[model samples]
Target: MSDTETLNKLRGVISKLARELNTTATSEGLTPTQASVLGLIVFRGPLGLTELAQLEGLNPTMLSRVIGKLTELGLIQRDPNPADLRAIQVESTEAGRELSDRIKHHRTEAIAACLDQLPETTAQTIINALPALEALAQALRSTHN
Candidate 1:
């Protein structure tokens, strides 16, 4: 097959994978954006509004609305930033932590199921490619700045 044909097939696979992840998360009661924010917290720990906005590649106002909704639902909490004085840091509450874990477990199970269908060699290839995938993601993020 031509390179273009190969790329097109990969694109379809990526879209399907993304949608599967999204559906799995949605089944756990979080929109994609909310899930993304929760991921930032779980991965990077607490951050100020501006920092979270940058981390999520979103506008502060949009992040604020998401944070507000999460906070209203008792999933997250905001506290005064001691260092910044004027800024507030957002962190997951116990409920948020539990919810995040549940979502992660759901995603893990879904992915494990998909991997189970793959040949062992293909699954190993994916495991080996993870570091490169992470590097590519970092490079892509840097390019935006």
Candidate 2:
């Protein structure tokens, strides 16, 4: 395929995958953004509001709203940062971690089922392209930042 065609195909695949993941997350009572926030907290331990907003590429107000909802659900805890008493840090509660795990499990299962239906060679091709795909993602993220 031409470069344009390849780009279009990649875009389509990525968009579809995002939609699928969002649907799975929503079914678990979390919006994609909330799920992402929980996952980040689980992976990174804790993050201040400003840091989390930058990481999530969301404006502070929007991130605050999502954080409020998550806090209300008892999935995450917001505490004053000891080092920076003025800033609040957010971390996943036990319930949040469990929910994040469940969301991850569901997403993995869904992807695995789809991959299982693909021919071995095709699946291997995708596996082999992972590094390149990751690099592309990083490059995109850098540009966004």
Candidate 3:
């Protein structure tokens, strides 16, 4: 396929996956952004406000509000940054980590079940493509940095 065609196909697949994940997020009573931010904190945290905002493509004010909401829910905590006393760092609480892990388990199980219905060869092909897919993801992520 042409590069444009390949890109379009990738976009369609990604959009479908995102919609599925969004449904799961909403079912847990969190906005997609809130779920995303929480997951990021659970996995990549002790993140400063500025770094988290940049990673999530959120403006600082908006990120702060999200942080406030998460804090109110007791899913995350913001403390003084050890590296920069004036700055704040955020990390997930135990409850937050548990919730994130639960969500991830559900998503993984759902995908695995779907894969089980595919032909063996087709499923293996998808698994084999993961490294290339990850490289593509990293390349895309770098573009936003």
Candidate 4:
């Protein structure tokens, strides 16, 4: 395939994978964005609203809405930031952590099952490309920042 064709194919595959993951997240009563927010909180520890907004590439208002929904669902809590009493800190609740873990487990299982169907050499090639893939992601993120 030409470079353009190859890029298009890669994009299509990635988009499909994202759709599948979104479907899985939706089944667990979370949108992709909500799941992502919970996962970030779980992994990064508590963060102030502004900080989380920056990290999530979201505006304060939108992030606030998302946080509100998550809070109502009991997946996250907004607490007063100790260092900055005026600012609020967001953290994943125990329920949020459990749901995040379950979502991750489902995603891993789904991917592993898909990879299992692929020929060993093909799967190994994809594994070997992980670093390049990560670099590509970082480069894209840098451009946005």
Candidate 5:
């Protein structure tokens, strides 16, 4: 098979693997939207609801509902932006941070178990290619933007 075909097949496998991984990771703690919102807060820093809605491709009312649920759960909080009284910045709580860490740990353990099943060389190949793949992804992101 050609390298392009092999990579495409690998990408498909990775997509399925990611979905499987997220199923368990997201089951008990939060709904998918909540988890994604929490993840964005954790990694991307606090964002106003408008910004978050844009990032998540959600309508304002829908984003409001999601934020309401998260706020009610005490996993997220919003503070008025100093420069924009109408805009509220959402941030994760300490509890949310703890939950995010736990999710990370659990996913890591699961991935490690799966990787252990692979041949040593196959595993090494993936590790070695990660940087190259990430660079490619960055270039793609820039192009898309």
Candidate 6:
């Protein structure tokens, strides 16, 4: 396929995957953005609010509201940033990590089930693509800065 065609295909697949994952997030009674924020903290956390806002593509006001909701749910906590006394850092509480884990489990099971229905070769091909896909993700993230 042409490069444009390949890019289009990738976009389509990624959009579908996002939708599926968002559905899982919603099933847990959280909006997709909330789940995404929680997962980020669970994985790459103790992050400053400014940094988190950049990573999540949310403005400060919106990010604060999300943080507030998560805080109210006892899913995450904010603490004074040691480096910058005025700024705060956010990290996942135990409950947030637990919820993130459950979301991951559900997403994994759903994907695995679908993979099982695919031909062995096709399934293996998709699995083998993970490294390249991860590299692509990294490249995209870098470009976002």
Per-residue CA lDDT of candidate 6, range 1-145, in tens?
Answer: 4699898998999999889878888888899999999999999979999889999999999999999999999999999999998989999999999999999898888899999999999999999999999998998999999
How many Å off is the CA of 100 in candidate 2? 0.4
Instruction: Identify the superior model by lDDT, candidate 3 or candidate 5.
Output: 3
As a whole number from 0 to 100, the lDDT of residue 131 in candidate 6 is 100
Give candidate 6's TM-score: 0.93
Better of 2 and 6 by lDDT: 6
Which is superior by TM-score, 1 or 5? 1
Give lDDT for model 4: 0.90
Candidate 5 residue-wise lDDT, 1-145, digit = tens: 4699898997898789768778754665677677777778877778888788877778988888889988898878899987798878989998877777777777788888878999999989988988988897787667755
Task: Highest lDDT: give the candidate number.
Answer: 6
Q: Write the per-residue lDDT of candidate 2 for residues 1-145, one digit (tens) a residue.
A: 4699899999999998889877888999888998988899888998998888889888988898999999999999999999999889999999999999999999999989988999999989999999999998999999988
- Which scores greater on lDDT, model 2 or model 4? 2
Query: Relative to the true structure, how large is the alpha-carbon lDDT of every model?
Result: 0.85, 0.91, 0.90, 0.90, 0.80, 0.93
lDDT of 4 at 139: 85
Kindly list the per-residue Cα lDDT of model 1 for residues 12-123, writing each as its tens digit: 8878887888776688678889988987786677888888888788887889889988899888889998888788998988888888888888889988998999999999
User: Which order, best to worst by TM-score?
Assistant: 2, 6, 3, 4, 1, 5
- Model 1: weakest 10-residue lDDT segment is 21-30
* Residue-wise C-alpha lDDT for candidate 4, range 1-145, written one tens digit per residue: 4699899998898888789987778889988988888899999999898878888888878888889999999999989999999989999999999999999999999889988999999999999999989998898889988
Q: What is the lDDT of candidate 3?
A: 0.90
Clashing pairs in 4: none
The estimated TM-scores of all candidates read: 0.85, 0.93, 0.92, 0.90, 0.83, 0.93
Tell me the deviation in Å of residue 54 in model 2: 0.7
